[model samples]
Target: MKRWTHPQDFIALIVGVYALLSPLWTTTTSKATTTMVVLGALTAVLSVIELVRPDTLSIEGLTALMGVLFFISPWVMGFSDMRAMSWTAWAAGVITFVIGAADLRVTRSHRGTVATTL
Candidate 1:
């Protein structure tokens, strides 16, 4: 769990990059491409912000929401016809969700000590 601290934001960042580039390697529709790139970019930006300000747990939740969006995007964006793209979306979504949740948990765990210090 020690390695699963705020620095763990790196997971989301990497996942974000993977999602963003997936369209390049896989066959995806315009809608799916847009969805992946937007959400991935947001995840990367938020993770960087979280790294700078450890107290920004909300960013973790936002990233998690982005993950959820990624998971549902194939259906929502009407790109399910591309099986490869859909699989990539689902897999990336799950990985991104896990990373964000882990980061949130780590941040919350440190909150008690931080409260006392304040």
Candidate 2:
């Protein structure tokens, strides 16, 4: 396995785990709980995949998509009134989105150089 190449992936992994376990400490509705668990797991999995295969640019895009989903989930799932949960979702979402998007940009820009050198 490739040694984790990107710091963003590590940060994403942390955010994912936090989101996954947040429901235990934070008051959350069933919908919020489910959303957190699902999105968190997906984030974690994608992060791991990226860490193992840093060249997979598509994974970064998916990670960004996950972040957007997380950001909007509180409202779409009707749990925005829960301050703790909503805030968690929004913060994690933004962090994940930014990391993913940034990584995607860096990876894409570097791709041509890598190909030309090979």
Candidate 3:
């Protein structure tokens, strides 16, 4: 069992699980479901990369942006009236984005300790 030691990984793991399950419970389908699943997988991948490397600004930024997109997908797509599930998904997205951003900031601030020079 790979123990998650980073916030990004924790968030990503949560997002990934949600994505893998949303299609079955959210009562949503097609494009929306597909997009959520894709974003979830992306988050998980980026989180793993951050765990291994933890110094790539580009990946962190991209992950955060993707998180934001997921958060607002329901609203922007006019699906706000969906249900608690949508709200929870959006909330998870926002939290994931924040975690990614915070990881970047922490890495930048503690570059000497966290980010290794290659």
**1-118, model 2: which lDDT tens digit per residue?**
2558689999999999999999999999899999999999999999999999887659989999999999999999999999999999999999999998998888887887878989
Q: Please count the clashing residue pairs in each candidate, in the order shown.
A: 0, 0, 0
Models sorted by TM-score, best on top:
2, 1, 3
Instruction: Give the clash count for model 1.
Output: 0
Q: Whole-model Cα lDDT per candidate?
A: 0.80, 0.93, 0.70
Candidate 2 backbone clash number = 0
Best by lDDT: 2
Among all windows of ten consecutive residues in candidate 2, which has the lowest summed lDDT? 1-10
Tens-digit lDDT track of model 3 for 11-110: 7767766765677777774766776777777777777776676555566677778679878877776666777557756876788788768866765667
Identify the superior model by TM-score, candidate 1 or candidate 3: 1
Over 19-88, each residue of candidate 1 has an lDDT whose tens digit, in order, gives: 8888898887789889888878887887777777767547778878778988998899998888998888
Q: Which residue pairs show backbone clashes in model 3?
A: none
Mark the regions of model 3 whose C-alpha exceeds 4 Å error after superposition. 1-4, 112-118
RMSD of each: 2.9, 1.5, 3.8
> Once model 3 is optimally superposed onto the true structure by TM-score, how far is the C-alpha of residue 31 displaced, in angstroms?
2.2
